[model samples]
Target: MLPRVLAIAGSDSGGGAGIQADIKTITLLGAYAATAVTAITVQNSLGVAAVHLVPPDIVAAQVRAVLTDIGADAVKIGMLGHDATIDAVADALADFAGPVVLDPVMVAKGGAFLLAPEAVGLLSARLLPMAAVVTPNVPELEALAGTQVEDEADLLLAAQELLESGARAVLAKGGHLPGDGDEVVDWLASHEGNRRFASPRMATRHTHGTGCTLASAVAAGLAKGLPLERAVAEARAYVAGALAHAPGLGAGHGPLGHGWTLASG
Candidate 1:
């Protein structure tokens, strides 16, 4: 049977990230995708113009409806816009029997804040504890851990701290690390140990929705029963390929070609 995965996230009208990215990632990886939209964002490749949050109760109802019937094998959460929504989602998934991939989506590709400052506290205290794995890019990691990550060593330490704070695992992405080097490295820290995934840095500015895509891909692997480390390994490869073959769309930071097919097949 195909693995079933649910996404609790906001809707990106631009279709590059949030619910749109989750759906694309899950479907492309041979999983069934379900959704409960937490907010609606008026956004594009350039920036986010506005965000309309869904009622907390309504969001909970959607999650309940999906869990009671379809029963997801894994859940991916992104772009939660408020504290109430985060609380509602936490409550809804309290007894979930599947892995949860939390993408701490604090800001948009254009540097617009997607998560409110108040919501961060709720997310760290409640949602982070429940996540099977939390994926935080540089800025999000800094916000959650309350410290700057200057190098790979700091990234590992931050991930360890995040795990100590209750996340089962953490992926501290290194995309924001400055340098004109040949490789980009992402640190994966878990209860088991720390490992890294490295890829040659592509010089493309079209990296919108990368965080959303990576988290959802991890969720897809977990839904299909891959172990955490293996799931992350596959997800990283997928994201790299997506970035390498991005379909040059919008003028500003464009989106990955999530549907890009392998030539071997």
Candidate 2:
């Protein structure tokens, strides 16, 4: 049977992030993709124009409907735009035992706030502990940890604190770190230890959906039974490939070439 991953996220009409990106990344990696859209954003590669949030009950219903019918091997969560939506999703997945990859999507590629301010605490409190691995970029890490992250060392330390708080594992992404270095490092911090996945940074405006794509890739890996470290490594590599092959569509930050593997294969 093909591995199934349920993505509980918003709808990016742009087809480059949120549920769209999750579906693309999961399917390209040979997994079945399911979704419970929490919000619908009027956006393209340029930026988010307006957002219409789906009701919390509907969001929860979508999740329950998928889980009870198709079933999922893993779950990837993003862009719960409201506090009530966070509560709804957390309650819906209370019994799920499979790996859950939590991408604390606080902001979009264009600086639009995806997650609501009041809901941040609720997500950390309710969902962080339940996640098998939580992927956070440097800025999101600073917000979640409620402290400043000056360097890679601080990034690692903050990730460890998240483990102490309740997370099973933390994939601390250094892509947003304060640097123009040749390589970007992502650290996987868990109770066992920390491992780093480093790759050359590509200079491009076509990384619009990289965060959503990477988290979904990781979830797809977990659904296929890869270990946490292996999943992170593969997902990073996949994102890199997509970045390198971006078609450069929009005037602003563009979408990744999520189906690049199809051509190569």
Candidate 3:
């Protein structure tokens, strides 16, 4: 049987991030994808222009409807635009008996703020505890930890702090750090242990939805019964492959080549 995974996230009109990316990544990994959109974004490869939040009740209804019927083996969450949306999602997932992958999507690829400032507290208090794994880039990590993470050592500290904050596990992305080398390292820390997944960073501006893709891929692996460490390793390889074969599109950061495996097959 195919593993069923649900994505509770925003909709990206550009089809590169949010629900779109989650769907693509999940399906690419041989999982059945379902979605409950919490918001709609007017965006493109260049940037996000505006966001229209979905009503909290509607969000709850969608989640309940999906859980009642199709049922999820895992859930991938991204881009909750407000405190209310965060609260609604947390409430909806309170009883979910599946792995939950949380991508702390505070900003867009073009530097647009996707999450409200007030939502941070709600996320920390209500949502973090429910996550099987919380993935955050450097800026999001800093926002969550209330400190500056200057180097790899700081990243490890930040991951531990976030775990202390509430997350069961944390994946601290190292893409935004200033470095002269072509390598990027992401740390995965959990109660079990800690490990780093590093890759030669692709020298392309076409990484609009890498975070979403990575988180969803992890969720897919978990849905398929892989342990957390193995899942993270597989997800890292998937993202690296996608980045390496990015389909050059748009005038700015472009979408990843989610169909790379299909081509290879």
Q: Candidate 1 lDDT, tens digit per residue, 1-265?
A: 8899999999988888899999999999999999999999998888999889999999999999999998999999998888888999999999997899999998888978889987898899998988899999888998898889888778888889888888889999988876677888898889988888888888899898999999999999999999998999999888888898898998888988898854325
**Estimated TM-score per prediction?**
0.97, 0.99, 0.98
Candidate 3: tens digits of C-alpha lDDT, residues 15-72 = 9888999999999999999999989999999899989999988998999999999999
**What are the runs in model 3 whose C-alpha is more than 4 Å off?**
none
Tell me each candidate's RMSD, in Å, in order: 1.2, 0.7, 0.8
CA lDDT, every model vs. true structure: 0.90, 0.93, 0.92
Per-model clash counts, in order, read 0, 0, 0
**lDDT assessment of candidate 3:** 0.92
lDDT score, residue 262, model 2?
91
Model 2 vs. true fold: TM: 0.99
lDDT of 2: 0.93
What's the alpha carbon RMSD for model 1? Answer: 1.2
Number of the top lDDT candidate: 2
